[model samples]
Target: MQQSSGWRGSADIWLQAAYENLIESGVDAVRIQPLAKQLKLSRTSFYWFFKDREELLSALLAQWREKNTGNLVKQAERYGESIIESVLNVFDCWLDQDLFDTHFEFAVRSWALQSNDVKAQISEADEIRLAALRSMFLRFGFEGEAADVRARTVYLTQIGYISMKSREDLAIRMKRIPEYVRIFTGKSPEQRDLLRFYARHNYTQEPYEK
Candidate 1:
């Protein structure tokens, strides 16, 4: 397909539109025509970037894998002074959407419910994420089963929050982080560690119950 009057939609633009549709409605709504209308571009413009809708959908999945899964693994591997701090590093994903897009993750998991190939991809992603979390625990001297269980505890709790679309006040969640870190790593985060975590999220006020 040729560009309309030399104005062609970029791949990122189209993919981002498709992503909005998927997260807002579902994957079925991510058609070329609707996206073209949404972008005020010609439907043929989509083809300039993608061969078909399947290619666009594949691109969405690839972006999800890179953004969500890739960032999660990187956070798990981030340097920290202790296991508690390490777990807090991974917690950045929960607070920051740029690190882990929970809504997109939920939408992809929902899409997987009806597509075997997508389901397989989601399963692979789960294992990869779990392995990274487990490795983080092992680096801190946790035993195999202990590391696996702790990793599951951390990962699944966040997934549950996404799946349930649970909403909480940000300050309240920040207050709970210290205990959550203790429960996940079997060690309470130091006052300095909590301060660092708070500063990272720009929670300027004190972040604990009196």
Candidate 2:
């Protein structure tokens, strides 16, 4: 007999499989048998972790809350020497998949259309995220109304990216970064800040003008 399988064979595997399945094939594809098959485990193993599909769905939502919502909040609260630096720090959310899961966020938003429970959670997520952005703007010296509008602009622009299913090439997006930062913060970014941004994104060559 095996000494002990321990938690290496535990709930996290099922949760991770369900998360991947949700991203690749939508919520409906996160079934026990399919995931078990993908993991080369028996369907019986799924029950060892999740009680039922509803529990699995709940786990998926919680995962999004922790990763997507949590990431946004962290970025919003990030400190930088200048407002532009702070904004660029927040922009890292878009570039780094580990810091922010756009696929998972979009999937959860789509699922919200069919489930009021999910809709409520997503709505709260939106409010929390937007509030964090607004606070960041406020901290940067923008007054109440201007900060609110800027916050909406930043948040809604990304929401639009998700809704439109935008796939603009990275170079194209990089070229527009200056304009985006200008509009969101109501001030042009410093040349040094722009250069740093490009360097971090590995686009040190002169970006094509758009």
Candidate 3:
């Protein structure tokens, strides 16, 4: 058996390299040999922590789901004050160019299309995120069906922003989010202004179009 210390170190290196490669290229571009080469390790080192390419890929996808998607939803739940803010934060999190990028979003979406396990994992994450947003909307005063619609709209906006590649375009798109929120929540100008101020200062601009 491999020493515990050596085993963990190798696993960490492998995951870090794999995630970088996935973000730079795409899921299909991630191969065991290339990842091992990037880490200056032999293929045997990869097998020490992961049984094969499939296992490594599975772990990589799981990590992406957990860190990129799951953690955001969890944090929003913890920090958000109003239902509107909580729901808006979900979009804000996805739009964060520093934390999230077009390539990373594409990697997840592409993996979902190619792998059943990946699709299920992403679907589960989406469900949780959407549910949390929906609940936040309800708490902020939106009714049953309307909250659901607003939650879906928020999800769509995130996806839309991810499709664009320019920072300037992204900012333009983000500027419109407040309007959508106002329409969904029926907030007056004062309420809309307050929300916009909070969103602008608190969150990163949406990915693409700065």
The per-candidate count of clashes, in order, stands at 0, 0, 9
Could you give candidate 3's per-residue lDDT for residues 1-210 as a string of tens digits? 232335335776777788888878878778988876777677777777878888878788767766667666664565556654555655556556454445666678777787887778878877877887677777777889998988777776666655564355555655666666566566522455445645664636533221
> What TM-score does model 1 achieve against the real structure?
0.95
Better of 2 and 3 by TM-score: 2
lDDT measured at residue 143 in model 3 versus the true structure, 0 to 100: 89
Better of 1 and 3 by TM-score: 1
- Candidate 2 residues lying further than 4 Å off, grouped into runs, are 1-8, 207-210
Report how far residue 29 has shifted in candidate 3, in Å.
1.9
- lDDT to native, each model: 0.92, 0.84, 0.66
Candidate 2's error at 146, in angstroms?
1.1
Error of model 1, residue 130, in angstroms: 0.5
Best by TM-score: 1
Ranked by lDDT from best down, the candidates are: 1, 2, 3
Superposition error at 195 for model 2 (Å): 2.0
Displacement of residue 2 (Cα, Å) in model 1 is 12
In model 1, the Cα lDDT at residue 71 comes to 98
Model 2 lDDT tens row, 1-210? 112245335687778888888888888898888887888887776677677889989988888899888998998898777778888888888888888889998889888888899999998999999999999988979999998899898889988898777887888888888899988887788888888878877887684343
How many backbone clashes can be found in candidate 2? 0
User: The CA-based lDDT of model 3 is what?
Assistant: 0.66
> Alpha carbon lDDT of residue 138, candidate 3?
76
